[model samples]
Target: MAIRRQDILAAAQRILSEYGLADLTMRRLAAELDVQPGALYWHVPNKQALLAELADDLLARVPEPSSRRRWDRQLTQLATDLRTTLLGQRDGAEVVSASRASSLDTSHLGKRIVEIVQAGGHTHAHASASRDALLHFVIGYTFDEQSHALMAEHGAAPARFGDSDAAYAAALSVVIAGVRAPTAGRAAPRPAG
Candidate 1:
């Protein structure tokens, strides 16, 4: 039977999950697929291309941003969804950071995020910065979470709750709180004892 592109990508994902991006060599992939290493060349030009394809495929699974809510909530939902997805797979955020927004589905998602920000009565520049801030924050946060997952796999407690909804609420609360305007020079929140 002919080798399929999806099969190659899926194999790459599995290998990345098992051995990490560093260990996923073309020869190893061929061994996994039970074919010659050259077989992958027909589907992807090089290791970088294979990595890019894997990133693209993984990022494509992030659900589209919705237009149904206040911009803050919409942005929060998008960021939280991204963080959750990245945490689900090994080294997922690292893979995402290596790939450009232009090279993967991220650019589309970024555009949607910016559109929501703009629609919320912000200036173009403000909306752009807002979108970037959220994206970078979530992506960075997810990378830390992925690292935590790796630790968890080694029998440590990340101790973070497993429920996606609750995690989102906790994270978004902090992130959205940061985005708020200064309270007209009001008193700062009291420090915890």
Candidate 2:
């Protein structure tokens, strides 16, 4: 059978799932695929590229916004979906955060999010800011939650809030309210003359 890029990615993902990001080395991945490490280079330039691919795969799982819902509700659902997707895999949030710092195409997700906010009567700048803030919150919150869960698995104390769902929901509500406030019949202050 021909060694395809997808084959390499699949093996890489399996390694990531079983061993976590810290252990996902080129040597280990090559061993997992029963190929020379050089062979992986033909498919992915390096380990960072492979990680970027994994991060993209995770983001791709985020469900599109529902058109029938109000903008704030859609944003809420989007944030919830993001958290769900990040928590689905071991070290998923780390992969995403690392990829964001790499040369990956994460703008599509951001564009969709901004569109949702814009639909709610926000200016483009405001929408973009709100979208970024929400994305940052979701990633940061989930990353911390997953890290603590890992600690708990190793016999650390249970999480203070029991789980992240309620905390995340409350935080998301605050962010959405802040984003919606300026548009809800309050005008921006004029620049000082």
Candidate 3:
């Protein structure tokens, strides 16, 4: 049997699910696939590249934003879907965040969010700021949520908060409201003559 790129990805995902990100190292992955560590480079250039690919694969599970929906609704659904998708995999949020910081080509999730906000009649600068805020919020929220869940699962600590789903929705609504603020699209006023 030949070890293909998908095979590597599959093994990496399995490693992630079964052992979390720390155990998803290149050497461990190579061992999981029963190949020399160098063989992985034939398919992926390095650990950072492999992690970026995995992050992209995880996010790809999120459904595309609906055109029929209002832009705010689309933004909300997209953020929720991304959070759900990240929560579905172990250390998924961490992987995506790391990939985002390390590589410019990893995922277009932020870009899509910017487009959604722009469609809502905001300037590019406003839309971009909104996208940054929204992505940071979603990713940071999911990372903390997952970490808390993991800790509670291992008896390290009880879940820190109650009604997380509601909390997330409420916070997202606040962000969307900020995105829709009247001044969001307004340019600086010219000084009076």
Candidate 4:
């Protein structure tokens, strides 16, 4: 039977969940699929491309930004959903971060955030900045959580961080508060004398 792109992605996701990202190599994927390593290249040019596709597929579970709800509420929902989704998979945050850094993330989730921000009366630049800040916080925060869970699972040292869920909610609140802050009243920065 000929291998398809979806087949490769499904196998990759299984590897990621079962053994983590370090074990999700093309060679391992080919082994899982019972095909020659070169066969994977017919569907994906390289591991990075495959990872990007997988990341997008994983993020597809997140709910799209809703215009009907208040922007802040919608942002809260979106961020929470993203965190939940990332935590659902092994090394998921790492995969998504790599995809974003490589400019291979095609989920358009960031665009949705920006649109939500703009709908709240912010300028395009402000909305874009907010999107970046929000995503960085969500992704980085989730990454730490996943890493800690892995360490605990392997019988490593006890966690130094306490109550991650509460901490994350508080930090997310701070970020959303900043986004909701009025930009109009801020005094213009003065040039250094």
Candidate 5:
């Protein structure tokens, strides 16, 4: 019998949830599947391939940005989409950050976000950098959200203040406010004086 690609991904997700990203091993997955490691190879060529597919799976289902909102709000929603998807399973960003542009899903999302940022009047270079910045923000925030292992290792839950969700949303609101089009600040020209 052939092991399916989705089965491989599902098994990896279970393993990741059970043992976190660092403990994910093809051999361990094979054992979990009750098959030889070569069987995994039959479905996935290597660990890098597996990681790419896993990351793709994670990034694939994110919601499309809404057009009726402010540009910054659109981006915030995009960031939230990225964040929530990554947080749905443990160590999702760990897998995603390891593979960039290797999957069509991630590639499409990257292109879409960059396009919107550019349309908002950021220079191509700024848009590129901002895209990376947004990705880092989403990944880092989600990592922190899913990081009980770090707390355990450090012997306590890290001290935090304020309503965390509100704090994050508020901070994002401020940051988005700052990422405005050049025309945003232009006052209407006065009559010739």
Candidate 6:
């Protein structure tokens, strides 16, 4: 049987889920695939490359923005989808966060997010900043969320905010507001009773 890149990635993800990120080394992955470590290197040049691919895979699962929705609503949906995807896998947020400072190609999702904010009347710089802020916020929040889950799994006290949904929504609202605030004449009004 040919040892394919997809097979290696699948095994890596399984290792990540079953044993967490620390246990997902090339040697272990090779053993899981019944291939030699050198053979795995042909598919993924290095551990960082493999992790970048995995992070891209997770980001690919985020739902695309709807063309019919308002820009703010679209941004909201994108942020929510991002958080859900990160929480879907063990240590997924860590995988993504680790790749952020690298030159990996995240243009697919990044382009769409910047487009959404730009459509909301932000300057290009502000749009890019907003997208970065939202992604960073969600990754950090979900990392903590998963950390709490791990703590609970080990019978330790879970550090938690109020309701997860409410907290996320509130924080997301702040991000959206900040993004919208810089538009010259289109600042959203405060909610009234």
Clashes of 3: 0
Task: Please identify which of the two predictions, 2 or 3, would achieve the higher lDDT against the true structure.
Answer: 3
Local accuracy of candidate 5 as per-residue lDDT tens digits, 1-193: 7888888899998999888888998889999899999888877888888888888788887888898876677898987778778877778877887776344324777777778888887887767666666676667776776675467567788555557667667766655665554346789778996
| lDDT to native, each model | 0.76, 0.83, 0.87, 0.86, 0.76, 0.85
Tens-digit lDDT track of model 6 for 1-193: 7797789889999999999988889899889999888898778988898898898899899888798999999989998998999999999988887776564225577788888888877789998888778777888899988888888889796566568888899999988888877654676779999
Q: Quote each prediction's TM-score.
A: 0.77, 0.89, 0.90, 0.89, 0.80, 0.89
User: Model 3, stretches more than 4 Å misplaced?
Assistant: 103-106, 182-193
Model 4 accuracy (lDDT, Cα): 0.86
RMSD after Cα superposition, model 1: 6.3
Count of clashing residue pairs in every prediction? 0, 0, 0, 0, 0, 0
lDDT string, candidate 1, 1-193, tens digits = 7899999988988899899977888999999999998877989878778877877776677886666777778777778778778777788888877765544324766777768767777677766676677777777777777777677878786556767567757976776665544243678889999
Which model is ahead, 2 or 5, in terms of TM-score? 2
Minimal lDDT window, size 10, model 5: 99-108
Q: Model 4: number of clashes?
A: 0
Candidate 5, residue 34: Cα displacement in angstroms equals 1.7
Each model's RMSD to truth, in Å? 6.3, 3.2, 3.1, 3.9, 3.6, 4.8
Score residue 193 of candidate 1 by CA lDDT.
100
Question: Sort by lDDT, best first: what order?
Answer: 3, 4, 6, 2, 5, 1
TM-score-better candidate, 3 vs 5: 3
lDDT of 3: 0.87
lDDT of 4 by residue, 1-193 (tens): 8998888888998898888988878899999999999888878878888878988898898977676889999999899899999998889899999887955222489888888888889898888778888999999999988898888878884756577678888999989988888464689779999
Residue 111 lDDT in candidate 6: 81
Query: Which residue runs of candidate 5 sit more than 4 Å off their true CA positions?
Result: 101-106, 148-154, 159-161, 181-193
In terms of lDDT, model 1 sits at 0.76
Give the per-residue Cα lDDT of candidate 1 at 140: 77
